[model samples]
Target: MPAAKSDSPGRVRRIARLIFRVCLFGGLAAIATLVVAVLVTMASLPSFADMMQKPNGQTVRVHASDGSLLLSLGPSYGDWLPYDRIPAEMRNAIVAVEDRRFYSHPGVDPIGVARMFYVAKRLHDEGRRLQGGSTITQQIARNIFLSSKYSYGRKIREAILALAMERKFSKAQILELYLNRVYFGGGAYGIDAASRKFFGHPGDKLNLAEAAIIAGLVKAPSHYSPSADAQAARDRASVVLDVMVDAGTLTPAQAKGVNLDSVTFAPEPKQNSVRYFTDWALSQLDTIVDEQAAPLDVWTTLDKRMQDAADASIRQNTPKDLQGALVSMENDGAVRAMVGGTDYVTSIYNRATQAQRQPGSAFKLFVYLSALEAGVKPGDPVVDEPITIDNWSPRNSSRRFLGPIDVRTAFAFSINTVAAKIGQQVGFDSVADMAHRFGITTQINTHPSMVLGTSDVRLIELTRAFAAISANGNAVTPYGILKVSTTDGTVIYQREAVQPRVLVAPFVAAEMTDLLQTAVNVGTARAAQIGRPVAGKTGTTSSNKDGWFLGFSSGLTTGVWMGRDDAKPIPGLQGGRNPAQAFSAFMRVALQTRPAEKFATDPTLPEWQLEPDDEAYFGNPDQGFGGDGAPAPEAQDEVTGEVPDVQPAPGDVPPPADTPAAPPRAETPAEPQLDQRWLDNVLRDQKRPPQSPPRGN
Candidate 1:
């Protein structure tokens, strides 16, 4: 029965022929349609010439604050360089590692693609991730234009786009764009940035070992970064070098010349000395000029060497608990150096210009200046005795009666009672006016306490104020930039000298200088003396909240302040200690090269007493003083630190017999014999009232 059912050979042959003919016709039609579809798609795309004509985005070069080149900051997209800049070894390494037959076909290599497909299939079978077979150009296309929304449709689109790109752009162009745009990790967007970020210089400057290491970084930047994994980076570099040798991109002899182990990297240079000054000048310029995009190159008066020395000095001298700021300028108002803080890294807030704090005894300079302007000689007998003005009976910082102290002693020791007396006599308004005229721009109260630095003042303002004394009493506005030049050497900005007279005659200025020198050599500011001729003043505010050391020499004038950011005091830390130490250390290094010169003093300058201003001593509005008529000490003649020879009875110095005695001890425990005038003004309001004795006693 099965033999009878068997089909004839002719029918089997006809069926087979029919099946073959139908399959062939269908395949031909499908092929024709696919070709037409591809042609239409190509026709719709931009012409090759038009695609090539697109402009790359702008490239902006970033420079250091001092105009030194740090890097070129290019846009994250679109910008590219020529492939000629790329090393041949790098190109070969990429081809050998990624697509072996990259140049053998058009944009999409069919055989390589097929081989990739087979590998991917194998990997999938083995439960592994799909390996890539993209040519460099194809990768560039995928990375630039396509989102990683994985799908068969996306893959087809990417292939078509890659083909379009290859047709439009040269291989060199495509490769350059790809290399520039590829992510190299560590926040580096391109090979150039990667070169800088990893090796601390430009890409073109790299050695062979560095080049190999960077070439290896393309595989997995973080994994091969020398900073992240030194051994891994070395291993990857070795492999990359081996690949170069195998591809014949590098000869064996040349490969031998390249030492992967010899590649060394340098630490990024920190240009901080000029940074603060540059920032200051920029800030000033921004405020002065309306246009921010003016592309200005400011020429500041910042002495780079001096600034570095000042910073170094502050670091060396300041205690762990202290932070310091220094500003120095010539009598002509050319700022030589400035230290904004001990570590600008720790706090960018500039203590020289940005911080506002009480001045303490340093404020007494204004009072004395005002007093001298008011025709009161330094020898004027302003009683040191505690006197009552309003309801306040102010005493010295020691809270005891000091007998027969002079004005010079009051200022040298920073006697609070005498400083108040002088401020009252000269009129607090006059002191405030002097402070303002001397370039102190902060708001100040016209109270007796203001004479003691109760008002807030920034270090810059005080620096300028002190500069007046340095300039023979001519107030000088501290300026930084001398001129700003464009890249092409066009002068875009220039600084102008503005000098305003704020004090009396140059004789008075000379007299003040002598007294200040005495202050340093034999008084409260003795700690500020250097081996060379130097002058400065030490000021400690109430509760040790703010420690101030302001001084100036011929070479540099710097002021340091030490305290907590908030008004709280650090334990066992004072301006005289840490701030003074920093100033001394900094000045020592700064003035090393400069010839030592004595401070200018005139013998023609009239001699003045160092007596405390009796009215100032008794008349502080913050503390009401009753006219109890305490016995006051007479103003003593100016003397060095040595004890006076003609010492009268302590009770009968010079003031009225009924005048009260001034404090016998110094305000600060560290200096028991110094005066305490300016400090009393700061603490008068905060000072505790005299305690009443027990009734039983």
Candidate 2:
């Protein structure tokens, strides 16, 4: 029995020694594997300089013409602040709230990591998110060299990189790098940028309360942003102050005395309409300048007051269910104000620049301009009788044809038949060319109905065409970017002041302006007259699906469009009613400070005297086409799916007498008489009877 007991003790000791040897080898293997992993990760990293560079490329800061900040595009990084430049309060607050043992730890805090895992496991048991355990130096390592991917391998690499950073950089250097690289809410990337964005100053000027508020954002930037919710930010700041007190950086009394209420935030703009302009301006940057690695300051032509005025006009005039867009530019094509929709936040679609809706009768400007360019005199007689071409007949909005009216009267009343006749005479291709020459970039359909604006057009381009007329025949290319420079004002791109291309002869433009003036003064666009010499055109599509008004006064040309996004009709909607009133309202405020200017009149062209027959046919200007003192409705152009209600003609009305006498004005020269026989022959051809359909077999 004694011999068996001794053998058992010896066997137990052998088993203990064998287990110890196995554990020792396993520990050694683990150490060797860790060393290999560290080496491989180190070799894969880029150089430190490359690592410290901003991850997202360059930022672009757009400014208005008056030097006011419109908005920042991309991540905005301010000038880097040295350790001395960073306020003590900001540094202490950041260290206290983010990592209390930052100064004492060797890059990675073991205690912090252990506490994080414990808390994370407890939170996981309760069905919550896992908590982060990133020290200040570890955070710097992850931000610079790695991404926020969760894995033990990533954590190990982060710790190793943090150790390497600590070995290379001083404590102050590490803190400075952290302060300069951290992201704050509102697109600010650094302490100085956050300070300037939130408090309108630099980081060196931050007080205790401001520092606490900014530091609190390091946890959840969007949630604790002061601009987003001031009270929540203040409460977060209080928590940061409490942490500072616990860390012994500030006394309890000192923390209590820091008045977060006294921290005043920078005032935000009242209107977000400017974002639409900024978005458009940003799109042009790549085309203007080469790909830039450094930040750019883009100065645009947006006028804040004019934008506000436009927003107010649209909100007040546009109906609740419908949407409206407006674009205004100088005679030289510097876009001043643009409102894409009623609210930019809900819809980012820039209707003024993006949407291509039918311009309706407002497009007649191009048709008439084409006619004038073809040597058709405004005073020449044209028949407004019913006409059909290619089995398609167009009717006037009034449904009553004024027989043998002068070209000016027909255009002023938006006579669809006369416009179609003029379009055919001038050639639809010629009208399309005229629109293109005036800056329309969209494709134009050349169907017979296209003369009445069947082809869809953008509001911005349409406004630019009118601006060309307002600028005395000079072609305008709409531009918003005035200059693009570096942060230190190094000029990268500046729009060179060049004389505009002359698209039309001054006399032709003058003639067109005369027709437009008649449109606003005595025709369908009478609602757009702002007690000044305003010239504009009104257009309404079939069933009132789209309403539009394009006008110009002083040195500005503005266009307004109102419609449903789905192209559905609005009840009782007409271009002359709402769109014209909106234009007038906006222009009144836009041109309030500027002097009223008269449209250029061609003295060479003679004014036609009213004949007795013509006078009876054309009623009072204010009473409109009905001659009952009721305002004329907008001209509705025919489109697909719309059928014209053609009423039976009363009888064939005879042509008016040829060659009316010319009235004399003090400023006008002696007028040359037009060839009446040529004019009559042209009118007769336009008034030809329609061909009858062949009998069915």
Candidate 3:
């Protein structure tokens, strides 16, 4: 008792004063720290009042040429909404579940703050994570202005910013900001977008049931959203309705009537085929107008029916590993259909628009066209006879020559020897020039092998060349966009129809068609017959790596290419098999309803006489043309391949796998001179072509 007694009243008083001074100092330091923190948070914020007038996310839509929607690209982050535009049900449901005393609070709810402190203490004691109890104002402050980090400092900043934002904006504006800027679910930011995305209707159209469902999503959009889980979303919606009924926003009877099971859900998006075409057309947009100037309304030239046909044909005809491409354009060069690949999901590489592959024997068309231009008649006698040009000795694909076959016959058979000779006789310059004038922008190889289609080229250019022939020599550059307008219907860019430049004379094209029709009727491309006269060529590259069937009908021209992406050889796939069959199938489907029109050409051959097996390839080209049946220039004597010695039946016709491949060049002291000398002598011998071995020998 004596030890517990106070030493003195004066000493106790001194101790009390010391303690008071220390407490006062500590309080002052804490106040100063809080003041500094408030200042720093104010410094970090932007002018919130001015930010209201600026735009939020903007969406860009792409449409097919037919005005059907393809896809939307953009700032799909969220769509903006005004306070008045929000439905009462949606707004009340949110307030009831998220913050009941939102209107009465200054910037933060003191009751919520105390509850969070209790939660923080209990969670810390349990070694678990703390949970948020933020008011709507504080949430808006954090999402719109402050970083989402949760720390003592960040919490302090959030409170300061919330108070500041509340003072600057009205309660209604703050609520509008919260509802529009808050993350709802499924990449949606705001009740407006969430409502539209999940219900397929606007936010203002939301009913009590929909509003409760959307409000429930605010807590965990991905977990509770109907798009992800139906049962979870319904459970959450029920909880939200209970909260609403407790808050007096909904009566018990109303809550009972609001069932999530009866609400309609949005349907899944339909698949789009025009995505690739629109992508390309948009790129071309940069050249003419800035699509950024306004929301664009692009109209393309894609024919939905033909596009589907092309896609279906590629899938059914080509192997899974071997990719294929098809591009079809009208004679005037308007791209009507394009199938970029079998499946755009696995690959976005537009083979029709972007891939460049060797056209193989397809290039021979250009070579023969040059020969035709140089006054070589379609019936002109050309030797399939094997002859050595220095080290480059060319042989026919049959490995056995048909002796002196006419140009029309050689072309129908895709004979390599005669093609190489034709390219040699005309000089490679004329062939290259013809290609350039016809819209082949890619560089052409000047070698003699160019005639055999050894060089790489895009399918578009090759298709364009064939289009020119179909148009009777009118040059065409493939174009897709027909018109581009703004959302207000003001035309930003309009493509006017203009007559194209002519590349070949009308008669030359007709003569070329006359020969090509024979190819489809009785030659290597017999598989491509569509019950009409189709003019085209079949091209198989060396090693069977690339096969092509580039052909045209009366008004439509189509090109198809098939090959491995790695350029490896395909087994037993020649131009006559897969490519030809695909081309025919695609054409049949594409023009199934359109009336069949014969090709517009003079001097056409009769279909019944020249059956696929008809040995009467003996009917002269000049005779069928109803022309001054000019005597074909004689072909000079040369060792073509070994003559088969006897006529083989039509079924025994060997595929001209390689128009004669260039045998290795012979080594000679005067190799270049010999090359020049052979070229010079080819045309001279054209008038005296070696006579064919007697038919049926």
Candidate 4:
């Protein structure tokens, strides 16, 4: 027994020695691995000078024609402020919230690290994850040199880089770099940009409360942005103030007197509608300039005054449940004002440029333009009786038609039967071709009812078509960007000043203008007249699903559209009732500073006169038409039909190689001759005023 006990003691001694050697070797291997990781991280580090000098990323700042800032496209930055220029309160607040021992610690704070470890152990035991414990310098290292991905190796690298940075730069220089590089939310980088974005002032002017608010944002930007939630931001600022008191940067009494309630943020823009314009302009940037790494300044053709006017008109005129869009442009297609919807915040879908809705009678401009181009005169007589083609019957809005009326009178009244008859007289293909020639890019379904504007179209494209008419038959391409340049005034792209392509003959445009003028003066669009030589057409789709007014005056063309997004009918809605009035209201303000100009008049053509019955229905030439009567409604504009194949079948389409072809059928006229009595009445009506004609409802 004594010998066994002696052996047991020796075995215990050997086991202890083995454990000690194994632990020592393991510790050395771990140390060696850590050292190698540090060395690798150092070698891969980005140049310190380059990191400090470079911006976060390329930004595109959009501005209005008058040089007012509209919005920024990418990461927004301001000029870097030096240490001396930064407010003392801002520096103090940042230090108190981010790192109390910012001045005393070498970049890796020992106390903070120990606390972080203890917290991490506790969290692990409770089934939670560890939170970050980076000091100001460590944050600078991570932001400038390393990715935000967290791992043991990343932390070791962060510490090593921070320590190196502290050794190279002074405390003031390090702080200045951190302030200028950190993201401050709201797409703003750096204190200067954040200050201007939230408070509308520079960083040098930050008060204690404002400084605290800005300082509190480093931890959670979107959650506590003042622009997002003022009360939450103020509560966070109060926490920052408390930290400042604890850090001895401010006395308790001084902190107590600071009123977060008195802190007022800058007013947000009246509406986010400008974002729609900016989004459109940004899309064209790639086509205009080559892909660039530096920031750019895009000067656009937005007129703030006209944009505000259009917004107000839509807001005040449109019903609450319905939506409205307005687009205004110069005669050359430079878009000056555009409101995509009633509120862009609720819906970013730009109705003015994106949504395609049927433009009712307003589309008749193309049909009439085609007829005039085919040698149909404005004073020519047309029958407005009920008609049917391909089992499809179309009637006038009034349900009763003026049997025999001149082309100008029928157009002014927006008579549906007359437009359809004209479409047949001039082939429907010609009408669709006319629309394309005038700048409408949407597909046109050319049915008999197409003359009444059945196919869908975007509001902006329709406005561009009208701009062509206003430009005296010249084609217009809608554009917003005027010039693009660098921040230092180096021009990257300037719009080339080229002559516009001619799309229509001047004589045809003149006759179309005459028809449009008659519509505004004594027909469906009477509400759109602005006490000047203005011309426009009113459009109302079936069940009042869509209403439109496309008009021009004072060298500007504006198109207004009102409808429900779901294509549901709005009770009692008509093109002349709300759409025309909105157009007039917007144009009145848009042209307040400009003089009214007259459309080109054809001196050789005979004077346009209304039929005897039409003169009585209009009541007075000075008061215009539809005084107390309801504005004309549109007939059912569309009907479902199978589209015929324009091309023949591929198989068995041609005769056999040896077969003889059949003879062609006898020719038939595409249109019947107009009644001579109607033409005789039209010529006689222009010579004298009517004596007594029946009044119309």
Tell me, by lDDT, which candidate is best: 4
| Arranged by lDDT, best first | 4, 2, 3, 1
Instruction: Summarize candidate 2's per-residue lDDT along 552-647 as a digit string, tens digits.
Output: 988999999999999997666667767876787777667767876666772111123223342232222222221111233443333322222222
lDDT of 3 by residue, 274-296 (tens): 56676666778778776663556
Per model, state how many residue pairs clash: 37, 0, 22, 0
- lDDT of prediction 2: 0.77
* TM-score-sorted candidate list, best first: 4, 2, 3, 1
Off-target runs (Cα >4 Å) in candidate 3 are 1-66, 70-72, 75-172, 177-270, 291-293, 603-697
Q: What does candidate 1's lDDT look like per residue over 1-697, in tens digits?
A: 7665565776788999999999999999977875565566556656544443332233333233254442333332323345787766556666665556666666778997788789988998999866466777667666656665666676676677677666656776666666666766665655666677778776555567777787787778778877678778888888877777787677778877877767775554454544555567556765554444334455557666667667666665555545667777776677777777767655777777788998877877788888776766554444567765566554454455455544555676666778778878878888888888888888989865676677889987887777778777776777776765554667656666674665657766666666566566445565455555556666666566776778877636677877767777554444445556556555655666676666666211112222244222212222222111121111111111222222222221122222222232121112233356733542452243322211110
Better of 2 and 3 by TM-score: 2
- Candidate 2, superposed: residue stretches over 4 Å from native: 1-61, 68-104, 109-134, 141-161, 168-180, 190-271, 291-293, 592-595, 602-697
Could you tell me which residue pairs clash in candidate 2?
none
Each model's lDDT: 0.61, 0.77, 0.70, 0.78
Error of 3 at 457 (Å): 1.5
lDDT of 2 at 578: 71
